[model samples]
Target: MAKTIFITGASKGFGRIWAEAFLKRGDRVVATARNTETLKDLVKQYGSTVLALALDVNDRAQCFAAIKKAKEHFGTIDVVINNAGYGLFGSIEETSEKEARDQIETNVFGLLWVTQAALPVMRAQGHGHIVQISSVLGMVTLPVLGLYNASKWAVEGLSETLAAEVKDFGIKVSLVEPNGFSTDWAGPSSLHTQPLDAYNKVKSDFQAGLTDDIFGIPEATTDAILKLVDSANPPLRLFLGKMALPWVTQVYSDRLATWGEWKEVAEKAHGK
Candidate 1:
């Protein structure tokens, strides 16, 4: 059966790639972007199967309105891909108030608003899947991306709790945590803060680590996403690249070791 999918940030990157994949497979898509002009190709190519809408996810009203319109147009939205966020590049100390707040606004609050809007429709239909495009940074961290890391961490926490809350309504939540991908996520779509001399070495090392070998091709993920949405039982979290597991495993192991080492101190803090 063909499903109706609502995807944000469909102008390019993973959102556009997945939208095209779904349309190719006969799924109806309500695709949105801040600039509808960028989505014209999808509309032209897919015609009636694709509905392109202009949306700025940071606007709460636009988020609600877009979802409502999609529900009305598609009759039922089987899946929602909240992929409309960008990365913020900067160290914690170097980040400005505006930069931090804007990051939160789009990556955190925007997703929350969209999720809130979809809950009502999904509850009424009694079945829907919501996929959040988080990052490996959600589970681990990298230097010079503290704000982006914080945003994904917020997304991870939010989506996990949502999965538990909406299970009774037949609404599913999944966080697609991708490792480095050859998407404009790190290019034109991202925002960077002014660098401080104190952190030049950190920034340089971070840039040095961005070798072509680390990034997976963006289009290669379409099959994985399709399978995820098609599954009768989907995972609460899905990592989308080779490096995600090893990176997360190492981080978690270190975390566990430290916690174990301080188990007595932790218990003492919990005083009877």
Candidate 2:
């Protein structure tokens, strides 16, 4: 059966790839982007199967309007991929107030608005899947990506809670945590703060850690996403690169070790 998918940020990168994949497989797509003009090619290719809408996810009213239009167009929304977010590359001290606030508003609050708008429609239908496009940074951190990491962490927590809360409504929530991909996330889609001389070495060292192989092919993710959307029992978290599991495993192991090492101190602080 063909499913109806409502996805944000469908103009480029993984969003465009996944939307094309779904349309190729005969699914209905309600694609939203800040610039709907960028989505013209998809509409031309897929015709009526694609409903391209202009949406700035940061706008709550637009989010609701888009959802309403999608529900009315497709009758039911089987899946939603919240893929609209950008990377804010900057050290904590280097980030400006406006930059940080904009990051949170678009990445965190934007996702929340779209998710909130879809809930009632999904609840009424009794089955829906919400896939949040988080990043490996959501679980760990990078030196120059403090704000970006914080946004994904917020998404991680929000989506986890959403999964637990919406299970009774037959809504499945999954976080697709991808490592570095050959997306323009670091290019046209991103913003960089003015560098602080103190953090120059930190930024350089972080950049040194990245290699060509660490970046996955964006198109290759289409199959994994398709399978995820089609699954009867989807995972709460799905890592989309070879490096995600190993990297996250080490981080958790170190965290557990630290907690265990501090167990006595932690218990003493409780002081029953």
Candidate 3:
């Protein structure tokens, strides 16, 4: 059965890929971007199947209004892909307070606003899926993009809690954690803080070690997304990419080791 998919940041990147995939499979798409004009090609290609809406996710009113329009246009949103976010690239100390706040507002709060706006409609309909486009950074830490990591980590926590809260309401939630995909997330879409000389060595080493092969193919990621969406028992968190599993596995193993290594001390601190 063809479904109605509501995707944010559908102008480009993974969001656009997902929109194309769903449309190709005969689904209706309510695509949104800050500049709705960017979505014209989708409307041209898919015709009435696509409804491009103007949305600046950071603005609460715009978020709610866009969702309202989506509901009005499509009757109900079957699945929502919150894929609108930019990375903040810089060391923790180098990133200004303003930069950090702006990153959180767009990446975290924006997602929340859209979800909040969609929930009522979903609840009324009694079935929906909310997909959050988080990153591998959400589970594991990265050096230069700590702020970006923090934002995704927030998404992870929120989605996890939300999944439990909404299960009884026939609403499903999933966090798609992609290992670095071949996107402009670290390039044009990123906000770079003024370089701090103190962290030159760390920055240089991290940048030098980067490789294109680390990125997963976008098409493969989209295929995985389609599979997840079709699943009656979708995972609370699904990691994409070859490195995603290994890296996330390491994060857990390290955490478990740390906990076991410090078990006595941990229990003492808890007054157990």
Clashes in each model (backbone N, CA, C under 3 Å)? 0, 0, 0
For model 2, residues 5-62, the per-residue Cα lDDT tens digits are 9999999999999999999999999999999999999999999999999999989999
lDDT of 1: 0.94
Where does model 3 exceed 4 Å of error? none
Local distance difference test, each candidate: 0.94, 0.96, 0.92
Q: Candidate 1, TM-score vs. the true structure?
A: 0.99
TM-score for candidate 2, residues paired by index: 0.99
> For each candidate, C-alpha RMSD in Å?
0.7, 0.7, 0.9
- Candidates 2 and 3 compared: the better one by TM-score is 2
Q: Model 2: runs farther than 4 Å from truth?
A: none
CA displacement after TM-score superposition, residue 141 of candidate 2 (Å): 0.6
1-272 per-residue lDDT for model 3 (tens digits): 88899999998889999999999999999999989889999899999999999899999998899889988988889999999999888899999999999999999999999999989989999999999999889999889999999999999999999999999999999999898888887789888999999999999988887897887778787779999999998999898989988988888999999999999988899975
Model 2, C-alpha of 158: deviation from truth (Å): 0.7
Q: Candidate 3: worst 10 consecutive residues by lDDT? A: 214-223
